[model samples]
Target: MKISAIHLYAIHLPLHVPFVVSYHSYDYMPSVIVKVETDEGIVGYGEAVADEHVTGESWEGVYQILKNTLAPVVMGKNPMEIEKLHDHMNKTIYGAPTAKAAIDIACFDIMGKKLQQPVYQLIGGRYHDEFPITHVLSIAEPEEMAVEAAAMVEQGYCSFKMKVGTNVSLDVKRIQAVRSKVGEEIAIRVDVNQGWKNSATALTALKQLQDCNLDWVEQPVVADDIDGMVEIKAKSVFPLMIDEGLKGPREMLEIIQKRAADKVNIKLMKCGGIYPAVKLAHQAELAGLECQIGSMVESSIGSAAGFHVAFSKKAITSVELTGPLKFSKDVGNLHYDVPFIRLTDKPGLGVDVNDEMMRELTVFHESVYLKEENV
Candidate 1:
């Protein structure tokens, strides 16, 4: 079926509680929602983690890219040809990967729907019937973070992703405190969010976390500091995982060749969508690096899509699709839970947008404008 139309919306979902990180802390999540339509009457939806505070893209930037760049290339093209569609969009704007990723994922959703197969099948067969995932705890006081970790553990989440870029020494102390509370059995991972002062400073802090027996440390230094990544991996006792450093297979290869990291944390929003993730995972395998799929704490719309991808990608070492927990409410009526998050066993992404749920949560709205002729 040929593509017909595209609808874009900016949805702002208020957080259940404030979420703090190394960059800008927030009380709400702003996401750009994309709906790509086909002539055969199928609709595929996708969401982007639109954080001007986190990355360079803002809500306005999302509007421009979707309308001015991505829309024209795919308007009449076949959705089945994701690679060709991706190539066309790439030609429109040289090396604008993020914009391409947003559309690329929506197309994957469309292909999954057309085949009546879940996205997982499209990438690879299921590795686990039920996926064991971790709960990513945001930055807070050592005591507060520990209490939350305790509660998550009680709920059957054995792994915890701790946000450490707030205060280096304090970050170390916080992990030590959480480790003490959770015991040695519960797996603990640290995400500095690139909060390290420099390669030297990151190494100093990593040594402390290694002593604490961290499972992995994520983005400890600036993303471009591949040399620093190599240095840390050589010296760090704990395995290193690259979150910000990887854009796709190219970056994955770079990290692997440099021995920059031993593990990779792939996010749907960060890499644009799930297709590139599958390709990236293959490259990770060749390099003997482990893979984990995580999210940017999006609404259920985004999280469910990620769940489908994580379930489908066999190479994923662990899963982190926790946007529903952070949100006061999820967008789609569906919510995935427990040892494995089960998206409805329906075809495609297995999610039906719940209008009422969206109506209640969306506090931001904007119009897509065609500033140029082809947009």
Candidate 2:
């Protein structure tokens, strides 16, 4: 089947609470939803979450790329030729991995539907039916964070990722309080989001945090500071996982060559989509580094794509597909059971967009395709 049309929706899904990291804070998720229609009447859905600080992409930019550049390239092409489409986009457009990711996921969804197989099986088959999820604690006061951590633990979440690196001492206190409240058995991780200005400060804070038994510390220094990560890794007791520094396979290779990090956080938007993400995970695995499949503040559509990649790969040691859990509402009906996100045997992503919910959240809409006469 060939492509018929592509639709774009710019949506703002309100969050249950303001999500704060070291560098950015948001009360709602700005996302671009992509729907690809084939001539055979199969439709595929995908999402691209806009995070200027992370992926350097915005919802408006993603929408425009999908309309002007991507639509023309794939108008009469086969959705199953994902690689060729990716190459065409790479050569045609300069930047906008998130935009490319949206189309990539939609194409994968179409391919899965055509085969009547789940995306996980199409990618690598299911290694584990369910994987443990890490609950993220947004930046807040020490006491407030502690309360939230305890509440999440009570809700059946065993792993937690705390947004730290704003203030070293206060962050220490935050971790301490959460640890005290949740007891010692729960797993806790920290993401600095490049908050520490230098390796010395990061090392000092990590040294102070040695007693917390953190699962790992992520992106302690600036994104470009590979040397800082190497130094910090040598000095700190905990494993260091790089997030912002990783773009794709080349960056992964550089990190591995430098021996800068023990682990890496792989996000679909950051790496483009599942195709590149799977390659990055394989590279990390070969280099003896662990990987955590993470996500942007996205809707269930983007989260489902991340979930499929995580479920298909054996190298993914941790998962953070908690977007649906953190959002006030999602555009799709998804199953969430605390630490696990269940996937179905249905074709494609196995999730459908909630039409009413999309109508409620949509802020902008656009569609692009060649007319029958033009084609």
Candidate 3:
């Protein structure tokens, strides 16, 4: 079936609590949702999150690109011709990865629906039913962060990722407080979020945090510093996981060749979509590097797309798909316990958008039809 129309919705959902990373504080999540309708009456849903710091994309930019540029290319095309669609997106667009990812995910959803199979199985049969997720504690006071970590532990979460690098002394105190609160046997990972200016500062902070028994450190130095990352990795006692530095399979190969990191974090929006993400994961696995599936603080629609990859891929060593937990509301019917997110048996992404909630959260929306010359 050919795609007949595309709908774009810009939704802003208030966070339950403000999320403070190293560079910015987020009080709300701005996401662009894509709904693809085919002539056969099948509909597929996708979402793209706007993170200027990460993907170099804004909500307005994502919406405009999808509505004006990408939608027209796929308007009358077959959803199953995903490769051709991807090529068109790459050739037409220069740097809008999240915008392209939205279309790719929606096409995959449509393909899964047409075939009457879950997206994960369509990609690859499930290797594991459920993968453990790491709960992230946004940058906060030492005692406050400790309390939050303890509360999450009490709720059945064993893995935790603490945001650090704002202050070395304060970060050390925060890690120590969390370790003391959670006690031994709990896994704690730290994310600097490329906050450290150089390797020397990262080394200084990591030295003090060594006693806290961190599982790993993520993006300790600036994203562009491959040599700095290699230097830090050499001196560091903890394994390093690259996040912002990895854009796609090419970057993954560079990191592997340089021996820069022990793990790589894969976000669908960062690499364009599931196709590239899966390819990157395979490359990482072949290079003997582990993978972590992450998100850009998105709704359940975006999170579910990441979840399908995390569930199906055996190379995924860790998961940070905690977007649903941080948000006060989501568009999809996803199940969340403390550390696990369960997917439905329904075909496609197996998550349905909450139409009423979506309308309430929508800030802007537009529909593009095949007959429209200018969407």
RMSD of each: 2.8, 1.2, 1.6
Clashes of 2: 0
lDDT per residue, candidate 2, 1-375, as tens digits? Answer: 788899989899899999999987888988999999998989999888877877777778788888888888888788898888888888988768898889889988898999999999988899877887788999999999999988888888999999987989998999899999998999999999999868999988988888899989999898888899999999889989999999888789899999999999999899888788988989998999988888887788888898899888888878888888888888987777767777888889888888899988899898987589755
Window of ten residues with lowest summed lDDT in model 3: 337-346
Q: Estimate each model's TM-score.
A: 0.93, 0.97, 0.97
lDDT of each: 0.76, 0.87, 0.88
Clashes of 3: 0
lDDT of 1: 0.76
How much does candidate 3 score in TM-score? 0.97
Q: Is candidate 1 or candidate 3 better by TM-score?
A: 3
**Model 3 misplacement above 4 A:** 372-375
RMSD of 1: 2.8
Each prediction's total of clashing residue pairs, residues at least 3 apart in sequence or on different chains, is 1, 0, 0
